[model samples]
Structure formats: structure tokens, C-alpha cells
Target: MSVRESTFPGVGALRQTGRLFALAASVVRLTFKRPFQKREFVEQFWFIASVTILPTALVSIPFGAVIALQVGSLTKQLGAQSFTGGASVLAVIQQASPLIVALLISGAGGSAICADIGSRTIREEMDAMEVMGVSPVQRLIVPRVLAAMLVAVLLNGLVSVVGVLGGYFFNVIMQGGTPGAYLASFSALAQLPDLYISELKALIFGFIAGVVAAYRGLNPGKGPKGVGDAVNQSVVITFLLLFFVNLVLTAIYLQIVPAKGS
Candidate 1:
């Protein structure tokens, strides 16, 4: 491919990303305006949570189990088996919770949002609302964004709890780890700030996923294929942004939150 052809997609992606950010900012501004859609927000909250919670629980268990197995094996080899709980718990809270929550938000909630809005767009329902002076961003997008944030934070906590439990069970039962040591050292290496940072990460990821899905849905091209493409792109874009944002947040947290007992 020629240089121009290869670079075109990159340029287009940057432009689309800019538009996504602008749409997110618009939703945020609309959120503070009058006539808050409290009903819609509540409905969306329930919907997103219903779809996300079970999947998150299923994923969190295996996630913690695998981590515990790996950490336990290495710690045993080094005669530091007692630290397995602390290590596994910290890993779940600091890394797994946010990441898993983000993935579910993007995959489950984001796709649903994209498909819902995309259908509205394709049917010109959004345009009809616009003609009636109903701001779609305020009436629809803002509530979904807020719902995603709320569900994400709650899901992160759920994931953390389940992950810790899974780790405990695996380490103590399957791996022959001491139950007392696991429980005693569970929080030994974790600081309060770690929990705060993990929640913050989940909040940010949810907001990003919601906004991107809304943007893609709102701006879909003509035809059913366009809606499908928008949904696909929404998931892909959310995943990309989620990982990048997680990396940046992790770095910032490390700088701001000192290690436990430090």
C-alpha cells in the first residue's frame, strides 16, 4: 500500500476519536441541566447491572483462581507461601477488578447501548426527537452514561470480593495453603488507596465505554449494516481506550499511593 493509503485510516481514526471525546463532553454538560431523566437513569442502571453482574461473577472466579494458582506455586517454591493471599488479593483489587469490569462494560453494556441507539438512529427516531426539541443527549445518552458509571463501580467491588474468595478457596483447598495464613495476610500488602484507585479506574472505564457507544450509535451511517459496524467499532474502540487509560491510571496511582507499610 502507498504511504497515503496506509496513513489515511490512522488519520480517520484520530478524527473519530476526537469526535467521540467531544460527544462525551456534550453528554457531561447535558447531565447538569434541568429535567434530569431520573426514571431513565434508574431503568438503565437496572438494565446494565442485570446484564453485567452474572458475567462478571463467572469471570471473576476463574480470574482469581488462576492468579492464586500461579502466585501460590511460585511462593511455595520460594518458601513464601503465606504471602499468597496478600499477593493474590492485591492483584485482584488493583488489576483484575477494573480490567474485568471494563471488558464487561464494553462487551455487554456497550453493545446493548450501541444497538439500542443505533436502531433509533436508523429508524430516524433520534431525528424525530430532535425535531420535537428533545435533546437526545440529555434524554437518552446522559442517563446511560451515568448508569454505566454506577454499575461499573458496583461491579468492581463485586469482582474484587468474588476474586478474593476464589483465591482463598483455591489456595487453601486445591493448593494446600493454610487457611489462617490466607485470611490473615489477605489485606497485609494492600493499602486503602488501592481500593480507591481501583474504583476510580472502573468509573472512568465505564464513562468512556458509554460515551463511545453513544457516539457510534448516534453517528451511524445509513442502513442496517451501518448499525452493525457501529456496534463492532464501539466495542473495539472501548477496549483500546480502556487498556490505555488503565495503564495511565496505574502509573498515576503508583506515584500517588505509597505501598503498604512503606
Candidate 2:
């Protein structure tokens, strides 16, 4: 374990993890305090969505096609070709879609947020707010974090739809699979919880991205270069946290939710 004399003396990752959760809680608490920053939230939502949506859709198509192709090949080999659509689409919806959203949001939206806030922090705007009896977390960080969560949920649904379509197209056209069987299999195998978990993952990931970015922004190093470094660190840290959280959530979900026909 690494040690940082700044925050936690004995450990590095654990201390940062605690700090990140603390920041998240602050953001959540500020979310309920009014008058809410509707305009800031709207602006941030539009900005994040504008930057992430197109790239997400583009990435999802190829992502879905690849999963469909692989699953199709496997099922065909096992003489379970009729289950290809269900297996492939479910994989895309339940796993790949949220991961894609997390990646884009962290890489694009989260990085932008980190850079913007880090710049403001280094410029002493955060301190000025403190001196003026203003809460920077309430005024700035809260809206951005909330916006990321909302956008992520919406984008998760969009990615699931587009990804399922892409997967279907590939399975049916490229793999010479039957469209009817594909639809039927998916209908038979997919449950409402599959979608619920996917959107939940996106929401959680979005929150993680925003909180990590904001936290790093709040504590950047001593200069302009530090802001850039903070942005990179925020993205990397968010990615690692998202993946770990995803694994844990997926395990819990599988244990709690029974499979179809099981």
C-alpha cells in the first residue's frame, strides 16, 4: 500500500476512496438544498450529452456487432443457434452498454469537468467562493454531478436500444440467423431486471465519474500543469472504480436475480 502524507498518512488508495465517498455524500446533500441550480444543471446536462451521445452510438454499433458475432459463432458450434439472439442481445444490454457509457462519460465528460473545475480551483475561484460565504460544492459541483447521473441513465437506454439493433442486424444478416428465432429467444430470456441493472450501473458509474473528477479538481497540484494531471488522474481513477464497482454489482445481481428457466 502506498502512503500519502496529505490526506491519509498510512494508506493511499483507501484514503482517497474514503475521500471520494465523502465528496459524493456532500454532493448528494447539496442536491436537496434550494434554491436549486436549474440553469447550471441544464447546461451541464446538454454539454455532457452533446459530447458523449454520438461517440457512444458509434462505439456501441461495433461493440454490439462483435458480441453478436462471437455469441453466434459459439451457439452455432454448440448447436444452440436459436439462443444466439437472446444471449448476444442480453450481453450487450446488461454488460456492454453500461461499460460503454461509463467509458465515454469518464473519458469525455468527466475529463472536461475535471479540467474546468481544476482550472477554477487553481485560479482561486473556489477560495473566493469560500470567502464570500458561498459553498462551491453546492453552487458548482452539485449540478454537474447530478447532470452526469441523469445523462447516464438516459444514455444507457439509448445505447441498449441501438446496441440490440446492431446485434440483431449482425446476427441475422452476417450470421445467417433467423430474425424470428432471434426475437423470440430474446423475448423468452430477457427480464425486466436485465434493463434495470444496466441503467442502474450507468447511473452509478456517472455519479462515480462526476464525484472523482470533482474531488481531483478540488485538490489539484500547485500549478496549471497540475490541472491537466488532475484531469488524467480523475479519468484513470474513475475507470478503475467503475470497473470494480461493476464487478461487485454484477455479482450481487446474479446472486439475487435468478436466471430464466433456472
Candidate 3:
């Protein structure tokens, strides 16, 4: 490549990075600035929670049940029935909750935000905010980002609890596992660290969703076609980022934190 051409790519990448950092910093600062806006916060919080709960509950419950069934069958063959709870609980806590809910937000909630903002951008509503001396980052971006993180944490907690309960209920109530034993095994093996890691994943993944959606919407080219394109691109990129970040976070969590009592 010619020097000028190569420099163009580097410059573009640097500009993108700078914009991303600026948005993230703005989001963090704005989240704390008007912290007493309880009414606004509660409205946004409800919107977020409503978006996340159904999917996490629906997906994780059956997922945990099926996971227990599979693990239980295998362990039964090896005369290690009690370990089913351990396997089911660990998998749900470590992988299912944040991963599944992140995907849901990527498609469901994230896409909605993208489309909403993209429409506003197309209509010049964002420009209006700019004209009025409102920082779009503070007014538009911060609440949603904070809400996403809050919703993610809530969804992760709900999923983990519901999934384990569903697994236990399914195994004991329908699949011939003893109820007391299953509960005992689950409680014995599941620790706070497993839950903590999942919460961390949710928080980070939520932030990624917010930033990815906002970045795509806020930087669209122009016009109706641009809005449509931004929405499509936003969904694809948000999904990709969610999965990629999930993998990296999982790796870091595993490396930095030893197993419970290990």
C-alpha cells in the first residue's frame, strides 16, 4: 500500500477509537451527574427490565432443565448422580445467563434502541438536541447505557435463580431425581463466585450493547436509507461484539479467579 493510503486507514481507526472512548467516558460521567432524577431513572429502568425479563426467564428455565436432564443421565451411568446439580448450576451461572440474555438484548432491546435513535437522527431530532445545547451523549446515551447495565444485572440474577429452580424442579418433580438430594447438591456446589462472575459479564455485556447501538445510530450517514442501514448494521455489530466480549470476559474471569476454594 502507498504511504498515504496506509496512513488513511490508521487515521480512520484512531478516530473511531477516540470517538468510542469519548462516548464511553461521557456515558459514565452522565450516569452519575443527575443521579437524583428518580422519576426519569425509574421510567428508564422499567423499560429496560421489561425488555429483558421475559426472554431470560423463558430461555433459561428450559435450558437449565434440559441441561440437568442431560447431565443427570450421564452422571447416573457413572454412579455420580449428585454431580448433576454441580454441572447444571455451574453451566447456567458461567455461560447461560449472561450469554443468552446478551443475545436477547442484541436482537431485541439493542435493535430497538438503534432503530429509535436512527429514526431520530434521520428526522434531525438529535440535531435539535445539539442545537438546544444538550449533549446527546448525556441526554440520549447515558440513561439507556445505565439502564442496560441495570437490566443486564437484573436479568442475570433472575436467570440464574430461575434456571436453577427449573432444573431442580424438573429433575426432582418429573425426572426421578430425589428432591432433597438435588437441592442439597445444588446448594453445596454453587458458590457466590459463580454468581458474581455472571453478574460481571452482564454488566460489561450491557455496556457493550449500549455503546454499540449508540455508536451505530449516532454516526449514520444521512437520510432514510442511512437510518435503515444503520439499524441493520447496529444489530449485526452488537451481536458480534456481545459474543466476542463474552468469550474474552469468560477467559479473563476464569484466569483471574480460581475455582471456589481452589
Q: Which candidate is the best by TM-score?
A: 2
Output the better candidate (2/3) by TM-score.
Answer: 2
Each model's TM-score? Answer: 0.93, 0.95, 0.85
Candidate 1 lDDT by residue in tens digits, 61-81 = 999999999999999999999
Best by lDDT: 2
Query: What's the best-to-worst order under lDDT?
Result: 2, 1, 3
Give each model's clash number.
0, 0, 0
lDDT string for model 2 (103-159, tens) is 899899999998998889888888788889888888999999999999999999999
Better of 1 and 3 by lDDT: 1
User: Lowest-scoring 10 consecutive residues by lDDT in candidate 1?
Assistant: 1-10
Per-residue lDDT of 49-137 in model 3, one digit per residue for the tens? 78767877899989888888888888889998877877788888888888877777767777777777777776777778777877777
Which ranking of candidates, highest TM-score first?
2, 1, 3
